[model samples]
Target: MADLEDPPVFLGFDFSSQQVKVAAIDGRLDVLHQSIVHFDSELPEFRTQGGVHLHGDGLRVTSPVLMWVKALDLLLDKMKTSEFDFSRVRALSGSGQQHGSVYWRRRASETLSQLDPDQSLHQLLQDSFSVSDSPVWMDSSSSQQCQDLEAAAGGAQRLADITGSRAYERFTGNQIAKLRQTRPEDFQDTERISLVSSFAASLFLGDYAAIDYSDGSGMNLLDISSRTWSEICLDAVAPHLGRLLGAPLPSTSVLGPVSSYFVRRYGFSAGCSVVAFTGDNPASLAGMRLQPGDVSVSLGTSDTVFLWPQQLRPALEGHIFCNPVEREEYMALLCFKNGSLTRERIRNQCAGGSWEVFSAALRDTPLGNNGNIGLYFDTMEITPAAVGLHRFDSDDTEVSSFSARVEVRALVEGQFMSRRVHAERLGYSMRTRVLATGGASSNKEILQVLSDVFNAPVFTIDVSSSACLGSAYRAAHGLVSESGVSFFDVVKNAPEPQLVATPHPAAQEVYPPMLRRYTRLEERVLQQRPT
Candidate 1:
């Protein structure tokens, strides 16, 4: 460690769905301080549930733009009260929940560039947004817009080929299309569109910040291959959209110095560089130090599987984003909407609502659950677009149910099997190492099924705030990225992930047949379901 008298530090911020968090780290990757401002609890004036408002339709979700601003103001104040040395920060980077957007009102730049150190950000910028309630990632009310964009791009596959994804309701471009069609006046008043990632960066830069490519890939308006906004897509969203979005930057770009506002109010160093902020997913990839051949499985409320791919394989399902750490490469992500909750439903029904009993059931069952398979989707699933519980036995014969013990094993196996199939569908073959994160990764039993399904060793790290940590790591890497220092080298000594589970000896023989059967069964279910 360097001299304690104002030793150099790096900062990372995560403007997430529910909270605004910051992590300060030393050069050696040791965390010096962590602080958070939760929007729902601390900023109750917003009256938000889990940081967003759920409309009556249950699909139109939004958060107050000023709420995010106020949370940031509150978070910085908390950090200041703790006597954190902000002046020691060498550089900073951040992330935000992907796909969400912020619409800056006309003349918003004037307010941003002229921020007064004496006034809080929230107080002065109350009217900065064109849309006070910004549509967030949870919003799925843009299906008409999604269909329109897909139709404009030729087809779903054609759109995916260009933008790294089909037109998703939650993507920024579709959201913008909806805004223009539904709220034309607000769309007209919008001067600039910033992905939540870049919006947070703008607060620090005191100017409009360019959306980074990694986060921009989620927008359905960017050409993944060229790393530029597609002119075809721009015309599809709105008129003269290019002027509003400006240019996209690489995730590693060092934008500029911290704003004078921060320097004066928060005592951040005048020389502190603000690196390009990216999406939370990309930041997590950087934080986890995900290598070319490594796969990351986050077992949270919604399970997500992502891996750095050797080649680009854009498909209708899943997504491909420009890699944050490797500019020349890309990352593939497959999200399962029915993850932890679906598993919990099975645990409660079959294991008496006890995780201990759930684990025992899993341990008691053999690999492949003796050729029984199931798909339990408590809600709509993203990958297959299918819901409801389906079960089958060794002969691929449809079965209404199975024993409680079998149901437990089938739930775990089915979830991982679906992940493997979808990941491979995205052109990612099984890699040797699987890095597991999130709340459920702590369960060794669940991880064993994951390991077996992927036929790889599963590893876990002590990551509480990966997005923030990843941004901090990005800040360090950005400081020397121009000199050709790799991200791996910058965080090589931070900490080693612990190997939690390895594939069983019979996994190779057991899973292939079971997976094949599951795939066919899934197809049958999809075919029978009404559109």
Candidate 2:
């Protein structure tokens, strides 16, 4: 390990929906310490499952904002136990779960500014939240609100052309509207609204933080082309929405020095700078240091395929968000709700709950699984908005079920095929090298299939959390940082991602027929759904 006198390290935090994660890196771009604190497992008193409180048949998903605050305390404590040096940190940046909103109670900023160094953060600010439970990215409780907002903007396509998305229930615009419609009292009491990213930054800066343009884009309130809140969407969502949100900023912009709380309580230097935090996906993009032709496939709870787009071409199908670090660039994103969890369903039901068994099942099945394709969505899916697990034979006839081995192959093939379709629909070419991240990135069976479906090489980074590493890297590339270089300049010399699996030669012949069949089946399933 390098001596404590080594060049000052930069700090990065990832305040995700489920946990608080941290990573520190030295000036030479080497990792110093990295760790995480899960909200449910570590803080059992909160009684959260996957960091969410679900209701109305899991359509409504919320997480206690205070839990995120406490997670910071626990995460910092863990870092201290590992002999982490807060004094070595010269700059800090972070990532948060995109689109989740935190409603601050009146005088919340004053409460934050006066946080007692003697008391824990969560304990001091228990009453600072106007809405204790925050509506998160998983929530779908605001369908009517979404429709109303869409209609108010003239139509779905018009809204999509303006804000980079048609109205989405999980988006902050609709969630804010839902809160105002259902809980007018709480809405009235709320002094300021913060996206989850800005809320985490507020805790560190001891002040209200400006929302980052990248995270703001996810809210369906940002005019993505201009990187500002759309007045049309704002008027539809609420009164005084613009005043509450304030202005958006570049992700790499430093807000100010670290709060006195950390300086006194954690031995951090008061001079350490705090940079604005952004969404986890954009952080991943920065961490990965994506090239123009590179595609990112994140296999998390929600599977996503993204690419750095040259132009802001918004479509009704997916979304376009401002690039987190490169303020002028935009990113195209296509998310599929049925990702790892759906894979788990097939793994449990068919592979006897063993990934080993699942791998064995994949090995047993042929490349095309004998012309069998499966559409597995354990819940309502976002990509095509299709529900149910439907199976089809090569002839396009619906089948009740397939063999266990076939089921495993079909699940892997189907998920990637959907990603391929949606990415193409959004004007993304699928032939580039795919940088895969998140939990499932390690699965060779999955990567091999991903490579086959996209007809590209798949690679995984060496670091554990791309978001955290990305955030840490951002800390070094920010305005307050010592590096004084572009993010690309800093990361270009970093370790390259490990090549996982490549598409088999036979896959070229196999996937084309299967993709065509999957396309037809997707159309059928979408048509069969009640409109």
Candidate 3:
């Protein structure tokens, strides 16, 4: 038990796209401390760009499993230096970049159950990974595998009916099947497979952690309706997968105490409970403490827009995932690959790398950019299944260039406008609020565009990392939630979500036709298959 002298705190970790971050929130749900381990710059040893290694001509992305382990060690050490009282931390939960996997070798259980406090985690477990490189969500190399799985499950629509998503190349069903086919030897050697979230939780529990329900929904293995593994879909992907995956638990289930590794090395109490971790997007939904109709727009390395829907309505364009906290509830999400990186590109090319200049330039252009709409996909995009940068004038004719200011405006406007179009396609409507989060949400000018395009009030929380904070809140909730308090009631008093930007009433009239323009242009782009 922790010292009753000081109030308890909860720790939340986000194993995100670019970094591993940890934040602590006090009993009242106020953020007390935060720390980060950036892969590219801080941990030069990993040599990762955006926390992953890209390969296979841009179709495959992976991160070293041990690199994440070492990052965990380094982040805790940094937190220790900040004088965060681990002994007072009653519970901890985490969120991981969605869909990336971690492979454990046959000796992994033995390796994980016993760790040397004298040796860093990376040093002791160097060879514990059966696959040195785990396939991540950005990998598109699984098209053939997706096809095979679709065939097994009957077809794409049938699979969607069962699994809550279509046969997307990035979904874990295809990723695992590809592993089974391409690296048969490695697959045979693997003892367990974990989504990156549970993998992080496993390190703390001194055992393999069960996948959380919300994170498992992303794997295309879970029947979101029934809340169990889809036997038909599982058999279609790999052999004996359920054994490797173990049983997925609720996001808020407390597994056990903190590992002795932390109890001995740091001053953490052995009573510190480790709760099941979940997908980053789900955590964001929790962090924002979404109400009935609010849309969550996360602007991270990938821009994801989600809404907590009343019931399951799986569609082909986006995905419907199980809600993290509640049973019999679901979430609808649409991801756009070109997010912050694309913003950085236009900031460099148009405004010489100055966000202030970029904001000024963007503000200079009118809404709808004088009837000019553009698409700039730095890489292949998720929605609309398109790639390449395209610009068009008022007449809808493709143009070579616009003024730098117009380009900046188009990039910001086009991204949010597309989000609106596809969101409606999924049968979602803009309700009272659009809750914007992630790194780019700090930009008022950019958020203004989001507000205008969505034609709803835009809001941002004071906390920068929504996923991590959500996990922290979950940690607090998991520990005392048996008292029968609702999740919203738990977070209601922490801080009011601020109304940051409001849509101009004129924007309602201006954006509808331009959204139509963005749709036509996207159609043209998607029609031309990769040559």
**Given candidate 1, what's the lDDT at residue 268?**
86
Q: How many residue pairs collide in each prediction?
A: 0, 0, 0
User: Over the stretch 399-514, how does candidate 3's per-residue lDDT look in tens digits?
Assistant: 99999999999899999988888777665664679988889989999999999999999998754778899999999888766677767777877787799999988998998888
Judge candidate 1 at residue 456 and give its lDDT. 94
Q: Which lDDT tens digits does candidate 2 get at residues 377-458?
A: 8888878888998999878899998888888998898888888877766666637688898889988887888888888899
Every model: Cα RMSD to truth: 1.9, 3.4, 3.5
Quantify how close model 3 is to the true structure by its C-alpha RMSD in Å. Answer: 3.5
> Which segments of candidate 2 are over 4 A away from where they belong?
1-5, 55-59, 81-83, 114-116, 300-302, 340-373, 389-410, 438-440, 443-445, 480-484, 505-514
Q: Residue 429: error of model 2 in Å? A: 1.4
What's the residue-level lDDT of 355 in candidate 2?
A: 95
User: For candidate 2, what is the lDDT?
Assistant: 0.86
| Model 2 weakest 10-residue run by lDDT | 479-488
Q: Which 10 successive residues of model 3 have the least lDDT summed?
A: 308-317
